[model samples]
Target: MTNENTAATALILGATGGIGGAIGAALRRRGWTVKALARDPAQAAAGWQNGPSPLWIAGDAMNEADVVAAAAGTSVIVHAVNPPGYRNWDRLVLPMIGNSLAAARAAGGARIILPGTVYNFEAGTTTVVDSTTPQSARSRKGAIRTEMERLLEEAAPDVPSLILRAGDFFGPGIRQSWFAQTMVTPGAPVRRIVNPAIGAGHSWAYLPDLAETFARLIEKPDRLDAFERLQFEGHVDASGTEMIEAVRAAVGRDIPVRAFPWWLMRCLAPFGGFPREVVEVEPYWRHPMRLDNRRLQRLLGNEPHTPLDTAVRHTLEALGCLDQRGTLSQAA
Candidate 1:
């Protein structure tokens, strides 16, 4: 397949997910031709498919033919595919990585951008982390991520790729996030697990901010070499108490937070969905993990972060938390 056009195109895998959807929207706003690939096209968010849309391709990232077709005529490929659950990793991560690398190679040197996480870091690290921070493969998830990076690096000899690692995400439409249905609901059973008095400084990445960062990187693909890793410290060093307070202020209510009991989580780990691997990483929630973003700030030139209150409010609104009257009346 060939094209006679000169305009750039970006193919985003996993476009229905939180980060991928945001990145797709950002790219579309930037006037790039955005092609989104997902397993089920019907599952994609509303209004993302209608009208003069960026091409929506239905495909699985693990399928070579699907990926190859999706990559055709694209200048950049964003690898955003993730397994549905923690237990699926042992079966899914490697194949997906391999297929993505193959698709990028087949695309005739398109820049491959991967959204990464802090799972590669270890416990008890005081120094702020950057691209050069020593990765400790201490946990199962961390080791899997490290191995994925290694695979990308090994394939870098023939493919141009970049990995941008950000912190835990919190933004609109993120129901599964730590602060979503778990912590923000009033009189909910899940609220008891999200104590804000733990005094841990955790990183939280807002989806829109990360999406904009990825859009900027896409515009300047030449800056990426055979392989590069970047750290985007979205928001830094905010304690759990401060975060909870900010959220409460945003929503105009006093939300309660209780400490997450590791013992209870361990007990529940035997269940299929809540695997032991999820409980094994509980230390991250209990300790501080700081990220250094000097490079990201320097590259992006002092973009203002989303204020905590505004971010929290926006998240709540997206979750329909603000539609109280209608929801309450319906329940009644």
Candidate 2:
């Protein structure tokens, strides 16, 4: 399955992560030849226990030569790798992107696909943003994200790129996201749902659906521009309470709802990096940043979408929140 010559060949740079792994599986399901580059193939291959495996090429993404060599004969190179736990992220993100751009150029105009974030936008902007929105970053990560897209844009026709920008991700195999880290406790039954973005609208992208959208675009490269950016309007919880309601429905009961304790995280910020990182994104929870996907819908006829309750249920089961509760995940 790894080395077959298919109509569409994609080399996934971060196949062990949520977006990269999901997209790799989705593309493979659609008959694309998939290859993955990893520093430790044995450890990275464990991430695909439940799905088909990609050609696990032993390589590091930071090395331009490794990326360029692995990207040979590939039509798409997905730049999804990031510094673990945001450690040295600001210093490392751009160089990794530069390497991807170089690898794309080496592959003779192979498209570089980046799974983008809302960090590129101003915090709490109420307006729904499209692909061309002028990014005014509010934090250092946002600035880094903005610069990453700038690199892709500068690459142009020689190294055409696709940037599918979306909001927060919540789905199966995602353990570090807001849904897993703050919304629901991992490995524990749902006692009470913790909501950080209670009253404000928030854009959420289910990994399965997001991965499918990438596959659709990769299926037809003609629709893409030399350097294109498409905003995916995932499950828009216009009323921030919708997600909480969906969570309750997914578990088939009314559960207590609790507002996330941002103050506690702030108090503990000095003691650890995780809490400090969590405190920085409080603005997103306080305000809304929605995406407009009319451009995406028109291109694909319709954007891939899943019901919020179903998505939440699957995520809960994956996180083990639905365990010990008989037949919860099995219920329709």
Candidate 3:
């Protein structure tokens, strides 16, 4: 079916989230009927429910019956749901995905779109990862992500799964990322930029661009492998200064840059919470890694790329850092 065909329905599991919201918005703009599952539909709809607002389905992703019911008549199942606050991932991540897989099977082989992550591979792997790169995740979260992909790969024949792995994500409405929490304080004017990358070249994915990539890939599903897994080479900064420069250009000022507070995170890690999780994944920031998107380029010719300055400007504006004229807003 064509993108605007009413029959082209998508069920987004985490439509309330950053990536899911972006994808849902993109699909809606493409004329796809998008539905999102949330625990409390009424409350979620009141929030910034991500682009053009999806048809909200009231249900919890952990409930297999709920997901199965929501998957009915859906052509694409975007499995973007995850536990809240990054807690209980060990106990929650697998079961939720299992539910999604079962729902996909029940829907008679709907295409499953998953926003992939770098956690599938450890630092020992090639600094540059592609479709065929071997995965040996060393961290606990990485292992969980690796297992998630393994399950998807195993069920590919029955589900027609598509996995697009990308690096650290930064985009509008994304508040929990390194860019949001570490680099600049959200709901406040841009001040000194924090460089957590520790001189390590980090791969960054602009969410809307990545979401658009998904929409394009879905348009030509027939060309994809039954278990297609592609890499998204969004923006690769070799010296880790490119992103800083982008931020500088976006805000139109040379904000003082500071090293990330590893010592603070280390102290908080012992107390347990998001800081602990952040500390656990320090290796990624300390080491350089990038995804190779040649396979994606072969399929789509060119992946969506927003200029870093433009992307950063939009992100800061959405985060309430910049005014309409690109000047810093009053500090919160």
Candidate 4:
């Protein structure tokens, strides 16, 4: 348990990213002292819109010494950093998390809050997943994700950790998301959107809502275990048409929906890049797996939720798809 001196102090490793920035802002609004560790603090400050500006600490997530130094006197460490452009994640992901675990231990039992994904579960898992779901994913990224949680479990008791696992992210300031990357193009009008649904269903998490959930759980450490995994039930698109419909509603018109080109991605897999990665995890889209939030509800009473249209509209606006004059009307 953190002492009175460290209770309100939080150190974020990826404050420029969506979930991290949101959590940093939420904590600051709650009167907690927040610090963000970045290689260039100035660059991070320019794009920071999570809640409020945090005290910038010059450091790198890959460097254990840097993370340990920045985590000093902090009761919480948000390890949300990842390799840019999904490049070098195999080489950089574990080591960076290693540093966070080390720093968390050095901070005297500080809780390390990890922004988790559904990647830990097998891509073909059709069952509704909860914290108790078995992690049997076989893809390269999935294996890496599993190992990261294992490291966290190994560090438990000494360095308490919480894995708040959720679906793919969609919100402002998100750089690495399937929503912005594949479903809709950023910095331009969304003429058409590709539905990720493939006969099954999918889940979408609003970053702001997920981050608010993190802050709520973090504020009540007594409710957390030394190592806890909570599945967040976000927007569960059961029929696989909800997201596309939401986009249409946000645009105030019936937009044409395109099917995701799985075969093209399969053909491009031989070239070795995002296509290869996508193909490797194709089973995720081929199956339905909804995250169960019973445990989360027990702790927080209710999960933070935003209306589908409102979330899509905000995301589209942030992604520069819609302008001030081109936004949706009240009756739309």
Candidate 5:
């Protein structure tokens, strides 16, 4: 697509979320006419504003009329909507997928870009997961994600759709993510396992990079026609020791890094947002999995990735972990 065509009208679902807001901003920066879709129009407009901002469409992603109205006259649709917790999956994911498909079809075959995750792969599969990795139907979350993909494929067989999957997200405005506010908060019961010897190597995706990649995919929707899956290599793949070092550098001092007991994590699973499915995936933290993005690089050409220090700094600042002197502290 030419520079002029890159600015085609695009609609993003779940625009109030961190990744969605970032993608919206990136698209607007690239000159795309962006529209943000949400369940509450007023709340979306208030939370998702970036300068002049995109059109805000308030409606449920599962509602046919709402989806239709949101997708109208749009050339691209980003299905970024997701349920708040695992318990809401059965009630939400399928319906949202169906609604998104309906909207895409109604919009006369607009490109549909859906955010995906590494959970689709089975446990103990050590290879760098790429487009062709066989999805395991073992875990509950994995099964749910696989089923969602199947529904999307069936719903829009002709319309172009892209699935960009990445590792756990950690960046600005990502309070609910596993590594960000969920684990790092001060005075919160949760804490990071700081043993460099044991917790040093883990893979995490930066939100800014993920957002930029999604924007690029929307700009070159045709490139997605030939491929069904894309994996993004995130900012850094380091051990827990390296992660702590990065955090210290970002915060400009050493901070306590204590691992939460597995027993406590299990105990809190019921009340906390953390589910049993998430605990099952904790092996990824101990053994980092590499996500090869050779195809993404080949397609998008030398895209800039956020540096480790810079990403850490941004994340800490977003979480209010930095003081005026650039020292790490608890959020007020």
Candidate 6:
């Protein structure tokens, strides 16, 4: 249970997403009254499929009035909404954050919690970064992310904000990330695992563990600064072999390991959309970067960590790549 035994209310903006759903479920488990903004409340609630029953408010994150209405009596506003299928982020990202900021002010200085990423850092530099790292990212998307945080920082004292930064996300509840796209083929048997950081190390954040960390942070908001960004030092596999080994163990057998086809991806980037966007951020995989979570460790006594083997096994099971016998299903 949270430090406060009283039932606190929270408004989640992206209740349907992986991070949002994970945090929402965690908060609900801690006796928090969680509410969400959705275009269709009934359909969104149906997506939960017998999970925690959060009050779904019919609205959109981009609409300021909708956001404010949803956050009426909430103490924390989780801003996890993102552009659908990672499209139109350049156009929609800031606007959505702007709406959330407006709502935060209207809701009487409600605390804002954001699931942050490593995009705010400069590429090909700083293998290990802490909360004090400068925001020098040069990529288009990274620049926008930096701007979003800037807005949050500027709104400090009025609208307190907490940004938990982490690396690539993987786990149940969402299958639209690098782990879901590259590491293993979703909804198929594990035949081959793809490695993006072939020759370098990479960081990965398990959704469940990260969500639990968020819940802990929310429990002790008094320890956090008005506008603070903390790094979640999740599983950092140096050389990328550790993660490959974990996946192999999860499959309970040897599987073909393939390197991501950066060559082909670069060639197809000209067509625009997801491919183009992915190719533009190749610097991240090429460089070795890991978040330093010492601060988070101090705050939470110790960051929540699930063993790689167990985390991988659960992820594979959720992705439908593993069967009851701990072997690959013959579906692929």
Best-fitting candidate, measured by TM-score?
A: 6
lDDT of each model, Cα atoms only? 0.72, 0.84, 0.86, 0.85, 0.72, 0.86
RMSD of each: 4.8, 2.5, 2.7, 2.5, 3.7, 2.5
Q: For candidate 2, what is the lDDT?
A: 0.84
Candidate 4 residue 114 Cα shift, in angstroms, is 0.5
> All candidates' TM-scores?
0.87, 0.93, 0.94, 0.94, 0.88, 0.95
Alpha-carbon lDDT of model 5: 0.72
Error of 5 at 41 (Å): 1.8
Candidate 2 C-alpha lDDT tens digits along 10-89: 89988888898999988888778799999999888875843779889999898999999999988999988987666888
Q: Candidate 6, residues 24-47: lDDT per residue as tens digits?
A: 999988888999999999989888
TM-score of 1: 0.87
lDDT of 4 at 212: 85
Q: Give the winner by TM-score: 1 or 3.
A: 3
Kindly indicate the candidate among 2 and 5 with the higher lDDT.
2
In the range 1-332, model 3's lDDT, one tens digit per residue, is: 24746579899998888888888888988889999999999887898546578899999999999999999998899998888865698889999999999999999999889989888778745588888888887777888888889999999788989999988889996777889988988888777898988756789999999999999998778899999999999988888899998888877767899998888999889888877888878878878888889999999999999998889888988888764444633121
lDDT of 5 by residue, 185-236 (tens): 6323222333322344466789988888888777776666533678888854
Q: Report the Cα lDDT for candidate 4.
A: 0.85
Task: Return the TM-score for candidate 4, rounded to 2 decimals.
Answer: 0.94
Clashing pairs in 5: 199-240, 200-239, 200-240, 200-241, 201-238, 201-239, 201-240
Q: Model 3 segments beyond 4 Å from truth?
A: 1-4, 323-332
Per-residue lDDT, model 6, residue 110, is 89
- At residue 49, candidate 5 shows an lDDT of 41
- The TM-score measured for candidate 5 stands at 0.88
